[model samples]
Target: MTQHTPHLWSRLRYRFDILMAHGTPVLIGWLTAVCLAIVVPASVVLVGASRDVPTTAAGWGAAVWRSVGQTLRLGGEVGSPVYVMMSVLLALVALLFVSALVSLITTGLHHRLLALRSGRSPVLEERHTVLLGWTDQVFPVITELVAANADRRRATVAVFADRDKVGMETEITSRVGGTGATRVVCRSGSTTDPTLLSVVSPHTAKAVLVLPPEDPGGDAHVVKTLLALRATGPETRDCVVVAAVRDARNHPAAALAAGPHGHVLSVDDVVARLLVQTSRQPGLSLVHQELLDFAGDEFYVVPVPALTGRTFGEALGAFATSSVVGLRRDGGGMVLNPPSDTRVGPADRFVVITEDDGTAVLADTPPAVDEDAIVTARPRTQAAERLLLLGWNRRAPLIVEQLASYVPSGSTLDVVTLADAAAVRGACRPGRLDVRFLRGDTTDRGRLAELDVPSYDRVLVIGDRGHAVGPDAEPERAADDRTLVTLLHLRDIEQSAGRELFVITEMTDDRNRLLAPVREGADFIVSDRLVSLLMTQISENRHLAALYDELFAAEGSEVHLKPAADYVVTDRPVSFATVVESARRRHECAIGYRLHAGAATGPAHGVRINPDKREPVRFGDRDTVIVIAED
Candidate 1:
């Protein structure tokens, strides 16, 4: 119904328009050349005309006839061929110069096209490792990595995060700059993408440590990354992929995702077990540091000589430089502070502490027993300990598994939940742990009071990952609030009962830890933050494990609170230096001490571990000695 008007420009003109839009510089160059050509020719012609040189053939014909006539009078036409040859040579030289310039532009485009085909962009060439997560623990992790990699050939680390990469880079550089490092590089890309992952070559990488995404229900990203790598096929199978997970329930899926050689670690059980070790014996992390690190000294599991058969106590001092800690018997069994009577057979291997196994100091002489000391240090009996678990999450099951090894028979666990969900993670059972489920609001004072809280020895506040708590809320904040509220109610109970409670809870926020008060014994496990910190430290200084062992060993070497009555008189205020001098005599490292005033009710009347010697040991009618013991 309408009459169509034709387009002012045709299809070819539209195509030209698009090309001109993109090649404005080229278009400008061509136009400039055309303008110069026209201007030069017109100016020369006009100037010549002004000087009375004709512009047409008629003038040329007249000029030729006149030149002939003039030649007769003078002489000039004979050398005109020379002028023509000179002009041709000059024109050829000009053409060659212009060709070279055009070649330069074409060559630039060729190189760019080649780069596109090959799939790479030229970038910074500094020797900096890259990190790819945004987290509170990132600063510490970078700090430790800087220290670990200080001896690298170059400086600088690159970080790619979910947040602005440049922003993360700037903030980290400003905050952790002073920690010895070369530099930090940042770029934006989702770490899960293979195209993005290629920016940091997994094949030629020094190391790759993946952290759990900030809000993933505990290491979901870590698991996904592992699966991504595994699915990448066999080429990258050998690459070392270290990932930290929060829940053991996800371990199987994570393991399946990790494939054959990758290492998937559950931070929950690892930290929980470590805290539990530190609780029973504080300073466990230090011992692990000593053993895990390459510097100072470390623990190595070495197979013994075929002829080496000696009792455990007798072989304690066998190694010239290494100190024997325990034996890893058979394949799966281990005896950490075995009885002196326990024999180290020819097939048995020893877990000994040394600077390095490559330069091992094997004992040349036969070892003998220090029977009296070993016998005196043997545990009197396996005492029953109480454990209380509040809330639920992925790590709940692993805690139950590791507890079986440390908690003695008859031990009890009271698991308190909201709506009191009754569910256990895969391949798990509470019966083995003597765990009893008490469905109630743990934070409620009356309800918490009704449960006989004072009877429990240890309270573990786990974060709830239930339906009431949205999956998107900050896990750490949610867990922390629950812990604070529960602690308040526990404090009230303790106020009336005048009984000390030992509480160890998980913390998501390292900064928010000061908000809660633990009138009873309490320790917070900031597992995720520390995992990255330890990884970076180990990456740079491989020798840190030696320090770890000295702090975490359960038997023989442990932080303990014993009766000072055995080592020092209570009425005296002995200086810490003097006590250290005394304890060092027995091969123990003295760090700090606890007071006996809190422990006098039971067999352990009052005992503080690593006490300051100057503190009056007024042997409270109820105190004992707190110390580290290398049994």
Candidate 2:
């Protein structure tokens, strides 16, 4: 029923706790001094007040001073029992107190070191590239950025993720090998945390890559990261924010959060469109890779004063080394493979594919056209074809929809999957395609054999997205494994039948693409890698987005590998200029050629883009010419 006031010592202890909680050096020093003041004097007094001590004040004072000196040195004379006992007691007390202080200091220092290693410290960098979030795509993104800045003396790429800084660095180094002149810095932090985001100095960064996390709700995480980036401040508002979202539904919200400077790439939609496009054209993936990756010829926007009054067609032949693919309007927007008659304005810039920006220069005189070799021919007519689709994923529906627009009316497509046939059937349009669903494991040799693999003109193997969701399975790795199994079975089937069957396989990870078996008639589409490449390309030059959209669309001009016999006399030596002249007569642009014999090999396969027109090359009957034409 009655309340008692707090004790003085208890109050002092509470105040000391408050000081320790503040974690300031000044308060810590004060606490240490207070501890020594109380402990040292108390130990000395207890020693002087012992049972056989002197009675005079001066004697007691002298004895206490001697005990203090002995305790400080942790040693004393052994002859006097009282002095010896007091010295031992004082020494024990002193050792205990000093140990406690040392322990406290050590623990505090350890925590501070942990914080520093965990990337709590702010990064001081300018004009760097900031990568927020971590996924399988980060490796490829870093590799591309390294190649993008290969010409620079030094470049920095700061990565902020909810992961261990050392672990991230180790993994990147192991996977990427070397970053050349680009220095990659990793910071452990949450992508959605604004304060943690500041560790990468986003305001001073030239660009930011918001990679979607490897989780079920990746789009949600991407959207949150975009919101955090948008909230950074006005200084970062104009900085390019390139993010990839897995779901189309979150695109609008992500875009709104990203504001005007952000470019949100829909991974699912982009992969689906690419699959649909590549399914019909076997070697198209190689063209996209060459254009997207920095290791080979890539797109470059260069201004040419001489091309001001020239038409798009006229400008095409102006570059001997570079291949003019499109033009960027003076005001805005990009038109890829535009109409031949489209006139280039004074302020227009040519978007050409070249090994480097400097190589995009226009030649003083265009290569001489071979009039005798120019054989004009009509575009090939559409014909009904059979397609076999193995496996299924979220992109299956979108791929079917896009494929429906490209195939002929009577074309038939058979989809084989372990998923529900009705669900797969629902995603397809019966009006455009004669759709049939077969329930089976696409990786099983028996199931693949039942589908008559050799009968289908083209076979597409879709990576299993569901396998990655299983317990103890990595999404990208699992999907890639399934894809690899299916590809191996398809290849065996082709080899046993002694027939060449066109195959396009989807891979979730770029690394797995390298592990895929080398088959003469197969093409691999690494979904994540391609998306990463496109994101990087667009991030570097936003105008390329329009060009990519047009290239992947069902309509418009697309790159194709046509038979060499269709344009030139096979086995006859002719310059690439003759092939270009021949393609121009048909209202199509001939960028390069594909050698059928080398099509299955690695690196360039048989695809050659932007070759020197003056060089004399011989084409076999089986070889194909690479051109951009509307079907």
Candidate 3:
């Protein structure tokens, strides 16, 4: 019997465990049962034992009601000592029951509040921009988006990332200060989770941007995020999804996941092309920056009925405040720097570079063209150049390939890095560029002297990605640190050689670009910031993706900085209109120019885009005109 009693006790404990597992409802039920057991027994004892209590049914009911009042802490009149004693015992049991009940309710409410604040709730926003994943790129993207939304009545940007909600908001607030009329909302979650992606309401968003993370597996996570968004709903397919990946190999998968309406960009391709292009032209990056950022002059497609039958060359002088770079056909094809005879249809729109939309207003009459100031001499013939590349990373091979496509044949490229020479040799397929690799540290002054840095026509420095990517932030800082050190060495070498080096430094962080020791007229390309700017531009208008594709392609009309002498006479002051007209004769479009004297100045960096055409500007012997032309 004793053993059976133990067994029975165990079974009873198991049943209690099951009951407790039922959560708040079951706990509340137990408390109610306890209250009843306390109140009913006390009432029965009071009705039967106390002589002051009546034995009638009505009396019993009154006693039970009094006991219930005592259990609930509501005072009731006591008739006798027995009744008073029963009431006191009921009060003690009631105290225990009330404490347990309050604790259970408090705990449940706390859990509910926590769940609500976990950023798991769905956003109730429509037509808002949704950005997934967090990186250094978020700040620039948010800033650009805010600028893009400046003219809107109301705008919202929802950011979803696997980070703390409050932290993201704080960082954005500090970095992108004062987003006027634009509301930025942040939610915390993983981009690869379908539920998390839905939390930002990507289906109803005006556009969705997927920012690749900073780790080695960032591209993989981006691919997963695209898949997750597709799994969210069918409506997401119709949404304008813009995604970017670090590796070009993952571009096809990302694009396929983004659907036909979506746009996919490769960071390596964009940055590599820009680096290769900017290495030749010093101030071209600043001009590209102005075109890419929203705070300054940018590309806008505006229809003008007045220029319906005008030729593409005549359209250059149609806008006084804007510079016409290209024309968009009715069939959605863009022809940048088209021939002088190319006519604009009634339905075609002009692609003008202006400060803002609607600001590309037409001029009543074209500005006076100084035909005598126009220089008709042909552009100087190209010559083979010697180039040197410092440091090596994942993008090094792409940069080399881009250089091969742009540089003339017989041009030699010497790559100096701490990495193995044979590995880089195997990766490079330099078609036109004569490639040479040397195993040495680029930061070492002795090795750089041996290579004769000043002997090269231009020097390109790329940050090492081997140490720039990892779970830790120190690696990225370390990579930037190495690049800065290399720049310092180059600066010292230039000082010793008494000759300026046309240095184009690739920086991982935008903040570190300011800390580099490069001399005046040097170019710094913050790779991630450029990627963010491109993503923001595409998010605002999907059609711009095709425009950018053509602009950045190797065999197209790209933005170039040619000698001002090639367009107009460099000996006298001339209006920008004259330069435009001169470029029109050569089948090119003149947008702006760079002053060799003010190249070291603040703000504009001597690069002016979309300047006042009627204002007469004097060009120095070394001044260059910014134009869109095919090589």
Candidate 4:
């Protein structure tokens, strides 16, 4: 029995340790047990020592109750010195145990609060938006989401990224300002970790937007994040997921990782295409901004039962406030700028551009068309022209490709960049354009003068990313400042030549656009802002994915700024209904017209979209009409 005593004590000690490790509640239970052990035995001893203790069970219970009061220091009966000294000792023991219990509860509560602030707790929200990853695009995306939720009573946007939870919240609050009625919750952790990604509860979210990081390997990380999101559960498969890739090569991989219901886009391709289109056509950026942002007019797919069996041409003037841009066939295909005589099926939906979903109401009667004011003049034939490109970056090659596909054969393009001439030539192979590269600094006035800036039909200044910066410096600002200096030199040259140049400047930040030199017929393309707008739009409505895909592609119908004279008599005051009718005759849809007088003005910048059809206006020879057409 003595030999086994040590083994038995060891086992009991192990069990006691296990019990104590159960946290505050277990410690409290043990404290109560210890208190009862001392109090009850002391009560029995005091009752037995009492001089006049009764022999009955009731008298013995009364005596023990008096001892309990003494132990708690509530009161004490007149007893001998031995009982009094023992009661004092019990009170001291009670004080020690009670103090430990309070301390445990306080420390436990503090630890739980810290855990919550660390973004380790799971979010319990339904139908919220989940944003993964972080970039400069988060500001605009969050701002637009707030605007999108203006009609709802309550909405939430939960953010999960590998950043400080408090820091993320502070930056968003500073940049986005007040988000009334919309709760923004941020979680910090590595997005690639599946365990961390589950904290935001992506399964219950209505939509998930994966923002591409600014690093070189952002696309790979985005793909991993998408796979991680999928690994969360099958419920996330039904939620709308959208992402963008910086390189075209990663688009297929990203789409596959995003699953069947997810949508992925190539940001480089979209920005490249916009650079090519906007360089030739000024004020087009304003039109795109109107369509992309939620604060202004946007595209909506609405079911128009009134025009189910009507022709596409007849539906152009059906809405007095909205413009019909395309049709979504009931079977599944999208036909944009289709033939005027194309019939709308019963289940087909009209793709209209309007301010709100309920504002696409059909008119009681078709607006009066000014037949006499309509012109039958043909559009000008394509002519070979000289084009000049300033600056260079990773997107330069894609921009060259898009320009080559759109320009006529034999058109000459001269590139003045700081990049290696041989490398530029190797990447930018000509399709229909005669591409030339000149190694020069675009910001130098003497270098820009050597190119004969006024001789080119259009000038493009792309943001350069080759500038060196410190580890703590902002990379985009250095490039944007360089672009601004180049623009200032170009504006000076234009002043000396007495001719306004159609300059298209590419900027990385939307705030820097306001700092760029103001020039007539000039436009700025904030690449990050546009991509954020696209992702937000798709997340809100998944059907727009295909619509925008068709709109941005080279082989499909695209937005064009054509001469207003091609559609209607430019000198006469005619209603917008007349322009719509004239465009329908030429197998096109006229959304709005740009006025040359207002081109340099504030606010609209000469661009008007989805205007009232009954308002009459006169156009000049230089004025252009915004339309969706197939070239």
Note each model's CA RMSD in angstroms. 11.5, 9.7, 8.6, 10.2
Ranking under TM-score, best-scoring first? Answer: 4, 3, 2, 1
lDDT of 2 by residue, 1-631 (tens): 8999999999999987887787788785896687668757976677667887778876666566566556456564454668778877888798889999999999999999998788778889998889898888899999999999999998999989999998999999998989989999999989898877888999888888898876778888988888887677674554677888876667899888887778888877888888888887778888888878988888889899977887888887887888877789988788777788999999999888889988888787898776766554547788899998887877777778878888898999888877766666766766778888878898799888888889998888887666321222246678779888887887788789999888888887777777777564357788788888988887777777778877777788778878887887765688887887777767778888888778768678888888998887788877888887887
Model 3 bad stretches (over 4 Å) = 1-112, 235-238, 466-475
Candidates sorted by lDDT, best first: 4, 3, 2, 1
Compared with the true structure, what per-residue lDDT tens digits does model 3 show for residues 92-114? 68788999999999999999777
Give the per-residue lDDT digits (tens) of candidate 1, residues 240-355. Answer: 55566766557678767766654556666567667666555432333343333333454456776742667765555445445555666765355554556677776677765565
Cα deviation at 380, candidate 2, in Å, is 3.6
Overlapping backbone residue pairs in candidate 1 total 60
Evaluate residue 417 in candidate 4 and report its C-alpha lDDT on the 0 to 100 scale.
75
Top model number, TM-score: 4
lDDT to native, each model: 0.57, 0.81, 0.86, 0.86
Candidates' TM-scores?
A: 0.57, 0.81, 0.83, 0.84
Query: Which residue pairs show backbone clashes in model 3?
Result: none
- Top lDDT: which candidate number? 4
Q: What would the per-residue lDDT of candidate 4 be over residues 422-533, giving only the tens digit for each residue?
A: 7778888758899998888988999999888999999999876673211112366777998999999998999999998888888878998888886644687898899999
